[model samples]
Target: MQIYTVGGAVRDRLLGLSVKDRDHVVVGSTPEAMVALGYRPVGKDFPVFLHPESHEEYALARTERKTAKGYKGFVIHADPEVTLEQDLARRDLTINAIAEAENGQLIDPYHGLADIEARVFRHVSPAFSEDPVRILRVARFAARFTDFTLADETLTLMRQMVEEGEVDALVPERVWQELARGLMEAKPSRMFEVLRACGALQRILPELDQLFGVPQTAKYHPEVDTGLHIMLVIDYAAAQGFSLPIRFAALTHDLGKGTTPKDVLPRHIGHEERSVKLLQQVVKRMRVPNDCKDLGLVVARFHGKVHQVCEMRAATVLTFLQETDALRQPQRFKDFLSACEADARGRTGFEQQELPYFQLLLDILKLVQSVDAGAIAQAQTDPSRIKDAVFAARVHTMEQHYQFPLSQSVTGGSG
Candidate 1:
């Protein structure tokens, strides 16, 4: 059987990027022949095998046909007769449909190398419209290769897919899967931008989509569009190399701004709490993981207070940490702070502003958490009073370090 490296391995190699995993397409092999040759069969729908030595994935040349609705409705055809060119034609992007022979010869059946050199994200064939997931895939690839521009034809097909309601048939898990991957990319805003351009964002993430036209206080947010601010925050999280939870928190932190009443104009008085409520709706609908959901919830509800904490009394600072369960989950508390910092730096002309609140808040939290709450809990004679005693200790400890005037402390609180 003749085998050739295909898909991402070839695409990334051509792009001069580090290829993490290699997938091979065996043009002349069957499930039984592959197994007999020492490869292990793992395919459920089509012939896929694990290499006996490297353990990398190797799939027989295959083609898929649309059967019904959504991504799951597909018929796969894989056999020894299928050509590598035919298999490559079925790929989503032109940049990914290229293949490489074992002799290091590049195969450009669909001009993937040319598109890669041109930094264009183009579909391999007209059949790109057959799969709705390709829209999300293209958006994610945009985020991955931040310098690449999407082909106009590809975008037109995506918009048509959305118009045909093909995007609506996507299941929540697959949507979340793509979204989470996109959020962690080097530049996440492009993912949202592409989705919005295709009209999929309005259907998939309306909470964020509504923020595009929403105005914000120009004095505070020079990038006065609430949607743009959120995108910037998410990009900042990515730039900081923060984890998925932190990035997720940044994305959903300002959902309330989208829902603010028109009469309120640019000022979002209770947007923090409003953001938390909207975030809940998104997490539930998207079935986001609990770790991400929990932090997003905390950041949504308390980000404003956290931003302004340096101005508030130490007692209130202690109460804020207690309310967020920061004392119990220090790591998550740290993530919450990181998300807030991303927000603070995401605005226009504010990225390099020497904001002292971040450092001050960290120092305050350290001092408050240093109090021997365990010892204080042990000293309490009444079991029910243990929580009260620990709370009192943290508040008392915070009072020692944060004795500044509330008005002075509130400086640089707006994010």
Candidate 2:
């Protein structure tokens, strides 16, 4: 059996990128032979093994046939007769099809090297359409390799796959997986843009797709288009090297604007409430993780309030903190603040502007966290008044910091 390093490791190495992990394709190898040689069987759908020494994955060179719908509907054939070229031919993109031999000889049967040099994303074959996940993969690759443009033919094929209903076959988990990865890329807007171009965005995320032509208040969002604003927000999140939750929050924070009445025009009055309602649908439909879903929902419902923090009274700010559970989940609260900062900086010509409220919120959360809610609870004479007393003390702490009037009632609302 001959083993060759393949896929992203080889492609990244050739492109002068740092290779994180290496995968190998074993040609002319059978499952029995691989086991005899000390490889541990791990693959459920086909013949894949883990090397005894390196623990790296070594999949037997195989060919696949589409037997049903979706990504998992494939019949695999792995045997001693399967060739390396056949395996490479089935890859999603040409650049990822190239392999490196044991002796360091580069295999370029698919002209992957040429495509890499030209910075193009070309599909390996028409078989690329068999797996609907390839569309998400291609879009994700666009986000990763920001400079690489999709080949005209490849884009056309992707569009065809969407039109044929292949994109709709994708499972919710896989959709969320690819989308989460794409959001973490350097220029995540490209992923959405590619999806939009192929009409897959409308199929998978119509709530977001509808935002493209929807206008926002140009005075606040110079970008004007709600869709463009979201793109800018996510890219800014990525630029800040923020976590996936923050990026996801940035992506969905403005969904309410897409549903705004045309009669209202640019004013998205009460869009935050609308955004929270729409976000719940997305979170449930995509089966989004709790961490991401929680953060997205918080941002969708309160990002506007976060942006208005500087002008808010101490009581309002205190209410915001309590409502977001900042005292209990400080890290999530920090993430929430970061996402709000991304939204503030996403506007056209506002990319480099400093957001004073970001630090203000953090500082306020920190100050309120110093309030000993546990101790106050222990001192409360009555059980029913415990919650109210703790809240009043916390509000008092905030009011002291901001120097609000001492005469303001404990239940006084922000005026």
Whole-model lDDT per candidate: 0.88, 0.89
Deviating ranges (above 4 Å) for candidate 2: 404-415
Candidate 1 residues lying further than 4 Å off, grouped into runs, are: 377-387, 406-408
Per-residue lDDT tens digits for candidate 2, residues 1-415, read 8999999999999989999999999998788999999999999999889999999999999999999989999999988898889999999999999999999999989999999999999999999999999999999999999999999999999999999999999999999999999999999999999999999999999999999999877677777888998999999999999999899999999899889899998888888898999999999999999999999999898887765565566777788887988988999999998988788888888887766556767877888889999899999889899988988888888877765432223221000
Q: Which number leads on lDDT?
A: 2
Q: Write the per-residue lDDT of candidate 1 for residues 55-110, one digit (tens) a residue.
A: 99999999999997799888999988889899999999999898889999988889
